[model samples]
Target: MIVDSPKIKNLIMSYLEEKKGKPFELAVDAGCGTGRSTRTLAPYFQKVVGIDVSESQLSVARKCTSHENISYQISPAEELPLEDASVDLINAGLAAHWFNPEKFGQEAARVLKHGGCLALYCFSLVFEIEYKDKSEELTAAFNEALLILLEFHKKVVCEVKAMYQELFSAIPFKDKQRISGICEVFPLTVPEIMSFLQAICSYKEFLEQDKDKATAFLQDLEKRFLDILGESASDALGFHVYYFCLLASKS
Candidate 1:
């Protein structure tokens, strides 16, 4: 599951710099999976720690991550292992919805230094393909296929769909802001998009329910996408994603 959030990170950095100046000492990537977001914070912070409950994910992160300042720990978001008031930034990238927000907020407040920043962000599953003649048809078909996955989606996904309102309210920081409709476009092929679909929790559950049917559903979706584009699976397609972010500062 690739969670791309460079834009959000840049925005967080700008906010931090405006509030606390440059060279942030430490950044904590809460519930970081495979450390993808952790690596993004490496350039902005002197040290970055990725905390997760999955040892398997951390093992992969340890092997794949090359940044000298990046480290992975098997820890939960609600209970961090760091010292009190030691972290400058805390980022929960697409993983905040799965956490116990009240407990996690307490931990965030406990670990964050005065004026430290907390950023929580998540992207939507609905993607837009902007082909002049076929855009609407393509989006309709894709969304129709996506409905099956949504039906099987977990509660956390529903929380994300609600834009993490409860989670945002649970944040201990008094100074907070929420931004929505942050769109990002990426060039991807039909196969690449299917790979992303396969990574979703709902898709995984669907697969477990009936692998053959799940496989066939994705295959059909890909075929429909290719048919609409009038291109091969290898042909590049534009995918527009919308994300929402919540920023809070400890005072």
Candidate 2:
């Protein structure tokens, strides 16, 4: 399982705690894919339920998760299976962009208790790498490759690029704020970076359209990156990801 950034987890939990107070009773990880973000909520909330539309994803989530307080469920972000006004927090990490805004808003309003909080967050798709003096060169290559992938997933790419400003604005909660430029750095090699990029939904979609072409495209992009990094291709580089978030409270 992918180890999610503790920095991002801490930021989300701390910010929610600040607004709603600690020892939250129930928190839902809406659209929790493979329970990566859901597991992060365990310590802060008494019970953390991970809800996703895909049972296959939920199966992986259940297998990857061991937190006694965490549970998995199959549900949609626009329509939760929980009781009305029963949740303290609803968090969607890298998943809200796919949800129907109006339906999700109503569902959130229905499930959240008075003053309950909703947190939606995702990292920038294109990450920057700091490798000796070749940081800018590698970053440019990544952006170039991302543009190639963008053609296959233009809508998702555009929404993320805008930092989900439209979704954030559509949240019915008047008491809400959008935060941007939260940077988190991780150690990852060039190959690891390539693997991460390929795991994106856009790339997977591209792969489904033409397997050989997609495979060749990714290989070519990896070659370009390796060429740019030289000897540092095998060495772990500082992968810097910027996170944008929307935090809101139910009235």
Candidate 3:
């Protein structure tokens, strides 16, 4: 989802361009789950390193990624392996909510060179759908169904839903800023949308709590979405997802 997003890529590029300095040599993707964000950084930086605490995720990333300038490592966000003042950019995509913000901030400050950039971003679920006459009703139903799933969300998910207010506040950088209401429209099928929701960690945890209820909720959601589309499960649907970003620069 993060890699296939053009808006996100443009946003990252625009942020880097706004800094307007020497080209970045090394970019660090902190808490990079499967190297999606790491690959996104490859074209912009001389070398991109993806760091995650999960060995399984790193193994998957190594297997899936073919970029010569990108590498995957097993490391925690609070204690990165990079040298101080070595990295030119540090990005945490959809993963900052899980980090100890203060420790990660200190580590980021240590690793990033003067005038380096730091970006933390995450996107919400498909909050709105663009169909014919049923857009409003479908969106309302989607929100209602999402509220049920959110009941089992982890604390970190709540932090993200709050637009990373706490995480932004923890960043010690004086040049920090927040950008919100960045929306992306994706053309996907009803089943595809449901699959995206199932991929979410919070939804997975919710499924673990009550598999029957979770299954029913997903089934109902799929049905509702399809019904609004007036087409089969394979029919294409347009979904709008909203995102927020926190950007900072080392002085």
Candidate 4:
């Protein structure tokens, strides 16, 4: 099991606790990739639906987390299969950006019990990183990496743009909803960093089709990592040097 961080666990739990024992027995995990976040809600809720747009990921969720109270389903954030005023909470971890907030917020409000909370949050770069000595090189690698990430986001820009327009334009459901944006710095080690780069960045896939760009990217990262630590690589990830987290909430 992955170690749960105190701050992250608290952020979610704090909101749930704020309900003051209202019994969050029914909840929804929208965009529940890999069932990681969904499983975390198990102890708090009696019936937790982990919904994702991808059937492939849902299969994995079914296999990995077979809890009796936790169920997996294939559904889009824009339209959920749940009934109105039934669920106690709806969560989107690192996934709200991919959803249409107009549809999502409206759907969320429709499905949730009045006063139900919605939590939107994302994980950011770890603070324990140490790549500052080779400041210029590291900065270049980080920025390039982010640009690549942005390019990935561009894949569904239409849905996102429409979603943002709807949410910001106050065209969503529940006039009594609340929005919150919060950020926190955390730590990550070498293996964690490498896993993140591999799983999330799709670096290997990018390399296969775009060898030249991938070559340039890795070459630059290599130079920076070596520069900061001479022959060996830097072991400590830099502290609070990144902004990889985002949050939006509605109640």
Q: List the residue pairs that clash in candidate 4.
A: 127-186, 128-237, 129-236, 129-237, 129-238, 130-236, 130-237, 130-238
lDDT against the true structure, each candidate: 0.85, 0.85, 0.82, 0.62
For residues 1-251, could you state the per-residue lDDT of candidate 2 as single tens digits?
13566666776677766777765999999999898889878888899999999999999999999899999889889889999999999999989889888889889989998878998888767578788899898888888887888788888888898988788767888898888888888888877888887888889998999999999988998899888877767888888888888889987
Q: Per-residue error at 88 for model 3, in Å?
A: 0.8
In candidate 4 the C-alpha lDDT for residue 68 amounts to: 88
Which order, best to worst by lDDT?
Answer: 1, 2, 3, 4
Question: Against the hidden reference, what TM-scores do the models get?
Answer: 0.95, 0.94, 0.93, 0.73
* Residue 241's lDDT in candidate 3: 84
**Residue range 71-132, candidate 4, lDDT tens digits:** 98898988999998887778776576677756776787688776566665544332234455
lDDT of 3 by residue, 14-70 (tens): 877677366879999998988878887888889999999999999889988989999
**Stretches > 4 Å off in candidate 3:** 1-4, 124-126
Candidate 4, number of clashes? 8
Per-residue lDDT of model 1, residues 1-251, tens digit only = 23575688789999888766766999999988888888888988899999999999899889989999999999889999999999999998878888998998899899988889899998865578656577788778878877779788768668988899899889977799999888887777778888988977789999999999999999999888888777544666667888999999888
2 against 3, candidate with superior lDDT: 2
What's the CA RMSD of model 3 in angstroms? 1.8
Clashing pairs in 2: none
